[model samples]
Structures are given as C-alpha cells and as structure tokens.
Target: MSTIQQNIELAIERWRSESVSQHTLSDSSAYFRLAESLPLTDLDAATTLAEIFQHELTFIPTSRNSGDWFIWNGIIHAKDEKNLVDDYLATEFANALKKTADYATKYLADSTMSDEDKAAGRKGMADLYKYARSIRSAGGLNSLKTRIRYEFQQAPDFFDHDQRWAVMSDGRVIDLENVDEEPLAPCPERPVSRHLGVSQSGQWPAPASLPTRWAQALSDWTPDKEVQDYLRIAAGAALLGHGDAKNIVTLVGLSHTGKSTYINVLREVFGTYAGELPPTAIVQKYGGATNFEQHKARGKRFLYLSEPQKQRTDDAFLKALSGGGDTITTSKKGQDGVEWQAQCVLHIAANHIPEFDTSDDAIVGRMNIVGFDHVFSPESMQRNKNLVQELIEHEGSGIMFWILDGAREYLKLGHIPVPTSIRKRSQENVVESSAALMWLKEMVDSGELVIDPDAYMKDMITPKDGYAMFSRWCFDNGEQLPTQKKWLKDIEAFNHMPAERKGKRSDGHARVWGVRQSAHRESRKLHLVQDGGSTDFRDLLTQLETVPTVQ
Candidate 1:
C-alpha cells in the first residue's frame, strides 16, 4: 500500500486494538488521541488536528493585542502547563509532525517495494513535507489563533483567573469548580476578573475577640468604638468591591498615628485585587503625568493612596470611582478606550483632608473621613516598625475573616454607619477648604451679609455683579478669590439661586443671585461704587433697605 493508505490502516488498527473496548469513535477527543498515537503523515496529522481540536482551544485577545491564546479544558479557559495554549499546541504539532515524517522516510527505504510504488510514495512524502513546512512558517501560529477568534461560536471570556471572582453580589463565595452545580448554579453572565488574594476561612471572631495585634491596631488607629467598627465595615465593603456606599474613606492623621501601618497591613491582605490609587483619581486634571494611570485600577477591588498632596480633589472622578455608578473610560496611547463601571473603592491616608469644591453636595455626602488621632509614642512606634509585616504573615487569614465579617454586616445593614467622628471631620474639612463658603459664613456671622429675595427689586446683585462684590470682599479681607464658576456654585449650594430680570442691567437683562450684603455696610457700598459700578450699581444700592439677616 502507499504510505498514506498504509498509515490510515495502521491508525485504525491501533485504535481498534487499544481503545475500541473502552471508548467509542463518537468520542471526538478519544478519536483525536488515537489519531495522535499513529504514525500518519505530517499533512494528515495537522489536518486531523484542525478538524477535531480547534474548537477545544480558544483564543483570547487582551487589551494590548498580544497573541494570548487559552484552551477550553471543558470547565474553564485555562493555560497549558503555565504556557499560553498556543505554545503547547505548537510544540505538540512539531513533535507529532517530526515522528510522522520520520516514519514516511523509513517507508521509502523498503527494498521490496516496486519502482512504481516507491515513486508514488516519494510524491506523497514530498506533498506532506511541503504542507508541513507551510504550517511551520512565520504567521502560521498567528493564523491559527485568528481562526479561533473568528470561527468559534462562543468567544471565551477573558480576565477570569478561575479562582476568586469580583465581589459576589450576594456576598457569598462560590466554588468555581462547582459553579454549575448547586444553589449558586446558573453561571455568572460575565466572569468576574478580580479576586481576593486570600479566601475567607470560616466564622469570623467577634470584634472584641479579634487577633490581638489586629484589635490593638484598630484601637490605636481609631479610639472611638464606632469608628473602629466602621473601619472593619469599610474593609469588608472594599473586600466585596462594594461601591454602593458611594463614599470615599480617608484615614487622616499626622505621622505615628498608626494610619500607615494599618493601611500597609490592609494592602498586603488584599493581594492581587489591590492597587495603588491612581494619581489621576486624586489630583486635579492637567496637573500630573498620566500614562493612562486609571487603567491600572482595572480588576482591582481596593485602591489606596498615601499622603496625596493637599490639592483640590477631582470631585467628579472621585465620585464615579467611589460608586456613583458612573462609567469610567481608560485608554492607552494610540488605542481605543475601554469603559466600565469602576468597582474599586478608594481609601486615602492623608495628613490633612484634600480640598474639594464645597458646593458639591454629592462630594460632601460621599466623604467618610475617619481620624487616626491616637499617636503611637516613640517607643511604641519603634516596636511596631515591623508590626505590619508580622500581622500579615501571622494573622493574614484572620484579618481576611474579619474583613469578610464586616462585608456580611455591611450587606445586612445596607449602609455603613457614618461614625459621629467621621461626620464631624468631613464637615470641618469641607468648610475649611472653601474660602467662598467661609467668607459667606463670616459675612453672615458678622451681620454684614443677608439673603433677601426682595434684593432683586432693589440692590439686585447679578451673579457676575455678585462675583465682583465677592472679589472686592476677598481683596479687602486679604483672602484669595475662588474661581467665578466655583464661587457661583458655592452660592447656589448655599441655597441662593439666580433670578431672571429684564431692564436690570445696561444690557437690559440679567440673572441676579439671591444674596446680597446689608445696604448698611458702608465699606461694601463704597467698594461697589469705586468698582466702576457707580453709574447703575450706586443707584441700585441706594434702593436697598437694612433687611434683617435670613437664617
């Protein structure tokens, strides 16, 4: 028989002898395995591989467009012996092709073969090697990978690590091995890409009975029992990637307050799911280097920033990342951007509260500022220099369990209870950062400013005119004037909306703010007159009455 015909017979006989009693040919994988065992020509083996095995392996294209291929091992798209699935396939193909080529070459040396038979076998061997050479050429593996992407009916989900998934919606851990088995059956619509580094062991210890180092650290970091409990709850919330709280947690204190130590421990415990909080998330846009830093937050559950500069926070970015349910888009240079709901919760360790536009109530509502006031003494600080590592090394699982407990409690509560101290700190820091609001408070407190709805008919302060007045007040008081936009935002936030009027300005139309200083403030009146508003502004102030300040 010709080499091809002879090899086909040998393959069938080998399968019949070794596997027919055990498995039917209808089993595609078993049949493929039988074919692999035969000394078939390279071309035939490669074709057989394509026909039976292509569907078993999947191709996953990553964000970087690297040729990352995975194999569908009936359960998950997994790697082959820690190598990309393509690598394993190429090695297997090369080895099998070499064995078959050697077999075909040996057959050509048969002295008993007739001249015509040898000539036909030589032609068949040449054709097999020619096709096999094409398979081994450049781009061959890539072409195979491309076919997998386009030919497969179902595209394999990327980023699933086959261990832990992103925070479970119900806060329960599901065994991925048994994902389709039980009460948690009905697989997730999309695989969760992020996982906790450590799994929760069993029942968590009571708060008072936590690991000694952890309890002591918590107590030292936040002396208030409520705040201490809130810290645990926050950790739990972070563990589950729960952003529903819509709040950014800041641990504020001076050095030696154990804040850094606690955050360090938390970072170690969080493992692969935690990343350094991106500077873009904390700093003002256009003020820092951004190499698509936000993209690093992808698949992370907790993001921690240490001692960010005391600049105005990126309010919108912070809100979105902190769980406002806003979509965050990240792009690499020369690449299309990817958009997803940000699942990571941010924790900041700050020596002081970062500034934010005080007018944003959403920003205000989202602030969960916890104080780390209890300073560790010099001796204690020295002793605990290595405490964070020790805690993680020995009490890592216990800490994870504690965080898990907090997560369960957070789910049950439906909200994290804002400790009294957190509320107080948040309010104090917001007020301190807003000079516009502070100026307003000073004016109202000093009986120099009043909110009069009737002022529109008399001393109508157009929002621009209001800004001019505010500018003069800031100049006179040696306080820097905030941007006009922010000043207006603050004014509106203080419940002062703009009212429309015709024939109210030189332009004959205006949107006047709902606030004004008392007409009796002679200095403000003179300043307004001197500010070149003397023509219309002087007359407007004349119509003002000494109205009592509205609380």
Candidate 2:
C-alpha cells in the first residue's frame, strides 16, 4: 500500500482502540496514550500526526501560567515532566489494552475476507480518518480547560480570571474576589417649562368706541393737490389689493420729509380700534417669536418695523422678516457650563436700505419701498397733522378700522387670488422701487380709484417737461452735467433771477436767450405756473391722454 494508505490504516486502528478504552481511563490519560500511538516516521508524516495528536495532551506547566503552555498542532505541552507523565499513565494503559482487542477482531476478519470483502475493508480504512479527527477534537477541549485552571492559580488577580465550575449544582461557581460592592445613586428628573398662549395682561385694550375728533379732522383737512393725489393712490391700492398692500408698507425718504408722520397716520386709521402696535414693539413684547402661533396669539395681522438701521440687516434677521418663517437661534453659555438656544421672529424696518453686504436676497425681495417726496408745501403739512389728530381722537369709532379688520379676515381665509397684472408688477418691483409706481398705475388703470385723468396728467406731465427743459439747458450752457444733481442746481440758479427778465440771462455784455432752464426754474420756484415755452409739447401729451390713436 502507499504511505498515505498506511497512515490512514494506522489512524483508524488508533481511533477504535481509544474509543473502546475511553470508559476505563481518565479523560487526560486517554489523550496522552493516543498521542504516543500516533505514527511519526517521515518528517511530513511526523508533523501531521503531531498536529492531530497535540489536542489530546493536557499541559500543566511548572509555573502554573496559561502563557507557559506551548501549543503544537492542536495539542498543548508544558515544561513540567510530572504533569506529562501523570496524564500519560492515566490514559495510555487502557487505550493499549483496547487496541490489542481491536487487532484480534480485525485479524480474524481478514483471514475470511473474499475479493468483495477486500473492497469493504479498504472503504472502512477511509472512514477511520473521520473517527481520528473526532478523538482529536474531544482531547483539545479537555486540554483547554486544564490550561485555564492553571492560569487562574498563577495570577489570582488576573483581570479576566473566572472560577466558575460546570460541576456545581447550579452550574455556576463565583469567585468572591471578582465582585463589585459599591452602591449606585439614583438620578432625579428635571422639570420642563411649557409655553402658554399670550397672556391677557400682555394685550393692549381694545377701544370702547370711536372718538369724535377723527371725523372732524378728516372733514376739515384739505390736503395739497399733490399730497392728496399720492394719498388717494395709496388708499386705492390698499383697497384694490395691489402689490403687497396689506402686507408691509415701507415709507422711504429723507429724514425730515414726514415718512414717520405718514406711517403714524396710517397706524391711526387702521390700528386704533384694532389694538395693534407698531412692529418693533410687537417683536419686543413677544420675545421675538416669528412663528404663526405667536403672531396669531398676539392678535397681529400686520407687522411694522420703523427705521431699522443698515447694520441690523443680516441674513438670519432678513430670512425671518421676509415671510420665510425661519427662526434665529443664538447659543449662550449658562452658569452650569451648558449651552442654551434662544429663538426669535424675522420682522424688520430701516431708515435706509440695508447695505449690500448681505448674501441673502430673500429678505430684500419681500420688502417694498415707498419713496416720499420732500416737495410738500407748509399748508399740506398742517392739513396732514389735523387729519391724523382727528383720527386719533375717533380711534375706535371710524369705519376704517372695520374695513381693515375685514381685509385681515379675508386674508385669513387663505384664498385671496393675486390678479395677473398685480403679480407681474410685484415680480418686477420685488427688487426695485419701480414696483410701487407700477402698482399705483395698475390700480388707476383698473378703475379702483376715482382719479381725474386731467389732474394726474397735469401733475405728471408738467414736471417732466420742466425736467427735460432743464436737462437741455445744461447741455447748451457748456456745463459739465451728466447727473440730476447738476441739473437741479442750475434750475435753482435760474429761479433766483429777477422777474423782469426771468427767461433771459445777462452775460455782462448783452442778454442771451434762457428759455429752457429759465422756464423750468421759474415754474418750480413759483409753483402752480406752467412752463409755457413747452406749450406745443404739453398739447401733444394731452392729445395722447385724450385720444387712443396709434403712435
């Protein structure tokens, strides 16, 4: 037979011998006896056999240390001879006796074997390899347990040492030294604060009744033709739902030009009986809550931020203000080394347009700019003041409050459709002041207001003519003017000329024609006077307004 076949036969014979002798010998003895019987002749054969048999040898080093065991193949060896010999004596004798009995039975069977029986014998030899593998595995388990015990004895304080035995009644044996005996304290739960709706005490009182002074003021007031026209358009736009009418109205102009006063009058007319305050105060009172819940609780339909500084406009602040419904969170360190988050709403207002440094355009688009003119006469200012005082006195009495309240209610229904024209205008002006004018023009075109076409044309056209004339004059007079400022200065100089030759310029030697600049300057300074030099141009504009002929 070949060397491999011979080794297979030997391994089978050893397995059968060990299996029968297992009952007679101690577990450790059986392992040692099998190792001794393993075939080891050629170097390769010896190594393979040693590896297969190593698992059966139980090692108990002289130092009683787990690390001292030298593992060969699957078996463990120790430097101590006493442990090796003891295990061998206990297991080898019985295994030898069993092997002797198996050999006797096989010898007898081989004598009576035929050609068919010879084939069966060869198959049995192959099955013996499996039996040898099983024996090796059983032996390895016993060796591992013995090594673990030796390791524990060597280092009683070993971090991973356990003295649990499977033979105990409960199958558990605890080492008293390994127990942790400290008490653990329980933790208390923290209380959390819940937010309640707006407090009754925090709300401003509603007016009991409309006062009488408001009516007298509105009736007695006679606004300048220009001022009246602007107010009428503003009111009509609001009534007709043009642009962001009920949303936010931004009055932008020079500081002393009555922007604040204009806002005040609007507040008196719409907020007096409604118990609404300006946007800044409202934001402050609610701790800057920008959500729908807080706004609804505070009974706010409109938010107003007056004269916000340029520095205050930031991305976070603008996002909150521009109906983005975003909150701003600021982290602050607490006394206990913890951080906190504070949130607030996004409403804002400013005296000047926000600086261009901000990267967020959402905030800018949501705001609308109303340019206030500084050309109001002294008489117009008096009339506006009287109208405002009267509205204040009649506070809760006027129908205007009801009208504003109705508008708010309508908006709350959430189905207010934006007309296509209005939407287009809003889109154009969302980033420009030109949107406000477009909104005004659309409102007039739609017949939302009772504007006298003649009066509006008269106001818009006459000023445009004077502006054009002054522009031409600057070009003719060798003036280095390319901007409005230079042209305005020249107009002012011409206006101060003597009345006798208002349209003439004296250049020391002789009088020169000054029709254009002089006409513009004179009309502006004197007021109510038309620049007659442009009568033909004025007629053309009038004809265009009156007749709808194709140009």
Which one wins on TM-score?
A: 1
**Which lDDT value does model 1 have at 361?**
59
Q: Which stretches of candidate 2 lie over 4 Å from their true place?
A: 1-247, 255-258, 265-302, 327-356, 381-389, 399-403, 406-409, 412-551
Which digits, one per residue and each the tens of the lDDT, describe model 1 over residues 437-514? 676667667876776655554454556556665676677778876788887666565553544432345345454455
> Relative to the unseen true structure, what is the C-alpha lDDT of residue 443 in candidate 2, on a scale of 0 to 100?
33
Estimated TM-score for each candidate: 0.67, 0.26
TM-score of candidate 1 against the unseen true structure: 0.67
Residue pairs with backbone atoms closer than 3 Å in model 1 (clashes): none
lDDT of 2: 0.34
The global C-alpha lDDT for each of the candidates, from Candidate 1 onward, is 0.59, 0.34
Per-residue lDDT of model 2, residues 432-540, tens digit only: 3322223233434554322232222223223233334334443454433334443333333323334564333233322211222223433443442254554575465
